[model samples]
Target: MSVRATTVLTHVTASAPILLFIEENGACNTTYNQPPLLILERYEEEEHLNLVPLNRTKHPLCNYVLTNRWPIDQNWLYVDDEGLHTKSIDREDVSIAFMPVSQIQVELNLHCGSDLRMKRSLSTNGEQNWLGPYDYGANKWILTDSISYNARRTLVNLIVKDINDNSPIFVGLENEPIVVGYPESDIEGFVSPRFLVKVEATDADIGENAAIMYWSTDPRVVVSPNTGDVHVHNTATIEDNYRFTVNATDRRGSGNTGSIDVLVKLLSSEEIVVITVQNSFLDDEDQVLSALNAAVDYDIKMLCASVVTGNIEPTYKRQQSDDLGVSLRLFVYGIKSQEAIKVDRLTSDLSDSNIVTVNIASVLSLQDHLDKLQICPLPGRDTGLLVATIVLAGVVLIITLTVAVCFFLKRKKEHHYDQFSDRNSLASRNDSIKSSKSEILPKINLDELRKSEKKLQERLDAANGSSIAANDMLPVIIEEPSKMTDVAQTPKETLINISAPDPKAPIVIQSIDKLKDSGADSDDDDEFGEKNKVRRKSVVTFNENVEKIIHLEDGLDEESSEPDIEVYKF
Candidate 1:
């Protein structure tokens, strides 16, 4: 079947139906190599069959295929049910395409110099072709096609499917050596998710063909698929001299890729610490420093004792033999102090191990949580202060000595006063004895006592003569009226002669009934009034021994008369 016109009217109005269909045959004449098609019959149910296409035996064949390759040989033919049909060879800009079907499109124009081109095909769409891969001088198509109406004027956007035209290019991946983690913090765990390196690529191809994906062969590292950032997956879990390669693959059909070598190194975690300061306030002249310097190896001893013990307690204050001080030495270096931590001297047991070549850091300056290092003071920095302290201490010493001497003198004076008191007491005792010796005037008069004794004898003789009965004359008791009996008296009056009683005599002591009958007006004494009085023994010889005998003076009451003193024969 063949179409004679571009437009046709059909009686089908409810819906225009596309009635295109293909045909196949076993022995139809194989001529133009064209595909079979079925002849149109009934296309719609509602439309009248008024339109029809007749088999056009006479028609022009327009070129359909386009190619980028230059034509070499030609004997073009089309085969179909009629076997093979010979096609005309009209020279144009080679409108027909080549066999392999290249993606490159070409538009033809003129040649260089005066080489005139042959005006070939007059077809509206035909273009002129010359002798090169591309027509650099072919500027004749634009103005002619738009204004002159001679050349092909059409802009077709052809999408050439990717065919792996380019390999991936790793951007900046020219054998560059990348190191991870700061040298100071070489430990494996320190490298966080922070990007170590970024892998990138550029491809001349467009769209998915140019898109690059990153991949690594090393297990210790991984790369982001979209960002291409290389990262440490696990450093400690991998082996040493650990290295691998990374590939940048495009999304092309072949996955054409470019690669770069990656080197993984476990940077050394150890560092050598070199402590530099402005100066250390160590007493270089101290003998302990000199001796310790000799005893210890040169390398073990640091810049100064103070440098080691800067913020800590001064080494001079450290105990050589003090037990408590030894325990408290570390305490003296409390971390609260803002000064750098240090030690005075290393013990023999720990000298080798504790005072090791440990690293503060490998950086220019050790980072103390981000603060800068403080400079040390100069040696013997307190000389003037020490001198002033010494002067003040001397004044204090002098004052203390003066006070002590004054106290000693005062105590001596007190002791002298005590001695003077003892001497005065001794003098008083001597004077007392001298006064006793001089007191010989006022002697007791014995004549008055003798007269009183005579009177008493007369009264006793008179009373005995009147009251005695001849039969009972032996020391009989007499009861007489009280000398002035103006006062009331109970049981009359009792007079006792108070004569000495013979030790052999059986004496009848009368009871004191009269005293018991007396009223309370009589002077009375407390029951224990004499509790504190000391009792004494006294003896008096009545008429000095008749012969010339000596008698010892005894303690007696001065008021007692000799006659009133009664001596008991017992």
Candidate 2:
């Protein structure tokens, strides 16, 4: 069953507007001129305006009209300004109905006996649409609508939100410029002007932003970008200000700039000159003299003494001299030409004698001491006699020692030989004395012994049948008394051949004179006659002694028989 109910809806309108409400089917209606209690800005788009409803009562489950106007329809009118009035044409003849703003819409929709359906429809009157959510009789509704907004304001919101959220945003400042010469921040009088100068500026912004252009506030200073070379007037005075400006510009024509001030002043025109003296003892030249001209001395006389010793080569000395000469010449030239300060006197006095001794002594002390080592006198330079004397002294000492030892040994040997000779001489002399006394002594009575030996020999010969010579027997009776007395008185020693007392005595016997002249009369001697003569001498001596002994014996025998008997054993 379909029913159409008509109510004269009135609206106060200065402009077309869309309305919002619920449909009789109980779904929210976004249709134009239907269930419209809420109004919004118009939608002129070709599509139907989508309207929304606000729950005026602030209810959670339902939406109701906020106003109490009796003639309210599902979605009808709204008033922006308050003076608008509306009267509805009531159809009293039909079934008259009034809603309690909330229950009326619900009852009407429930009386329709069907679930609600919603649509977005346009009004036949051609009013512009307002976009909002519509909840005619639903339990809930979300109002949605769109109004033309500012895109710029939306972007600004996003930016503001990022800032409030502490999001990252990058920003950079322009780079500072670097200027030539003295910086403005520099202390005064620190740097002088008329010096070569340069200036530069940099910007963090890219492209042409980083380019630094230089400028000069003072015309005296020139700034060049192509070369980055700054040149100032050479004659600039101390009071002169050479200000250079450097500008850093970005592609956006934004940049920073800096400036430098350069002051020019004259240098003191006084140069300090210090002189230090050095002496080398290990060099050959003694007392090196360095001479400087009058130009180097305000008082005009400068004499320095430099000495060198030991490694003492000519070259080392020459090198030192050359250095001294150069220094002196340079000093003189500098003073005379006004290029440097002149020396009126040394600033400080120094004596290098101690230093020279210390250094050179340190080097040479390790060698043998000059006094200790025997230095050969340069040959040909010393007298030759001294050298010869020394050599001779050495030789004499050696010879003297040799002679002393030899003499000592020789004397000892001589002493030993003397002792032996003395002993031998005493022994030999004793033997000779004993031998000579024995030989010279008469061993027996020579006369008597000779006579007895001859008688014995004759008796033995006669017994043995050997003939005795008559001449030998005649010698016994006819002997000369004088000859016999001569023989008897002569003391003679007998010598036996077997037992001779003298070692030098002759063994073969003969008369002394005959033996001495034997060689001279050797031819005249007759062997038999010589033998007879020898026998006669023996026989004569033997008979004489016998006669004497017989006489004596007879006398002795007669005397012995009596008391006064005298006898001798012959």
Candidate 3:
């Protein structure tokens, strides 16, 4: 028979003892076999059969706080059962390791250090894995079991806090000791507040750390806290010069502050009196000052003086010429109001020979007058245009005059040529007249004349039947006079004489000496008679031929003892 025991054991420990007893109860009593048997049994507890409490093994997310720009590679927290435990395990049975989650894992892997460190700077409003209130789980440290090859991971949240590490620095103050002038008063003697300068500063920190405030210790100087604009107030007690410091502080406090120096100058108000004089009267500066002092009865302080010469308007007297005189300008100050009035009145008097004029000077007026008072005035657009117009007009006038002269010379030459042509024509006419006179009065031969006379006598004697002697029948020919005396010897009588035997032919007797006497008398009449004397001789010769023809036609037998008369008249 086999004895087998089946019993349920609860709350048993490993390596504990167990007892088994068998009893016979059907035939006889079997109490003698077993007096009490105890067996020693050892058992192993398997990991899968063990139960673990939920509270003992936990996966918790740990949070840690750090500042930006903290020490690198510094241990912030340890991944162990004591400080960063998430599982129930012995320190030697598990391996601790850390890995950054998300994009920060790449950053953590590059650094080989065991401890955690902020490799990069963090900000409140930054786009980094760790922020000012970093709530995202950025890292996970693992507790891996060495025996079971299981891992227990815990999340680590890194919070980056902002610190006030940067101080406020002044900006745009490179010209360190800033100089400002005091405000000038108006005609009512009331000075208005004016802006002096603006101060600026910058900070590197963010949030409340970057805000700045401005302040000044000087009573007269006021600064705007937000805008950093400086101004002056209550200027009645201002000094000639003031040197003070303007401070700039961040919102973090006095530890982060900056300062700069500023200078303020208070100048006394003054009036500028300009005195213009002719250089001929007061060219020297001392002379101008003396004359001004004498004219106004006050000692004048001349700040500056200048003299200009050449082609400038005379400051004293009016003149037409541009080169009037030298202009002397005197910049005078420290004159009383009454003296200024007196100077003005004297200048306006025109009788005052020294000073040209005296008037209040302004910045613009002084600059303008000084520009115009140059020794050589610059030619402006209008001046250039006037010069161009004058030159053009002069050129046009010269051209016109040249053309007129050329036309006149051409007309005069033509008129002279016409006069020469007329003289030539008149000379040609005179020559033609003289040539006709020579041709008309040809030389006669005496022998031919005698022969012709003898023939005519023979014919007349045959016709009349009267025997006439040769000497009596032939007509006489008178010689022409060669000299003026020969012409005067001729008598003033009938010019022609002829006697015929026939009653039908009237007897004609004319004296040739009378024609010569008439010609001689006409020659003594005027100056032109001398010129007509030659023409008269031509007429005398022509009449001689006419007498011969008459004697031949009428068979004249009677003849006068005087030479046959021949008359020539022009």
The local distance difference test score of each candidate is 0.37, 0.29, 0.43
Q: Relative to the unseen true structure, what is the C-alpha lDDT of residue 47 in candidate 2, on a scale of 0 to 100?
A: 22
RMSD per candidate (Å) reads 29.0, 42.1, 33.7
- Clashes within 3 Å, all models in order: 17, 27, 12
Give per-model TM-scores. Answer: 0.25, 0.17, 0.23
- CA shift at 98, candidate 3, in angstroms? 31
Per-residue alpha-carbon lDDT of candidate 1 for residues 437-468, written as tens digits (9 for 90 to 100): 78855565678767755755554444433332
Candidate with the larger TM-score of 1 and 2 = 1
Better of 2 and 3 by lDDT: 3
Q: Pick the candidate with the highest lDDT.
A: 3
Judged by TM-score, which candidate is best? 1
The C-alpha local distance difference test score for the whole of candidate 2 amounts to: 0.29
Model 3, position 235, has a per-residue lDDT of 62
Model 2 Cα lDDT, one tens digit per residue, 394-493: 9999999999999999999988898778656888879988999988955556788777668545544444342223322211112111111132243232
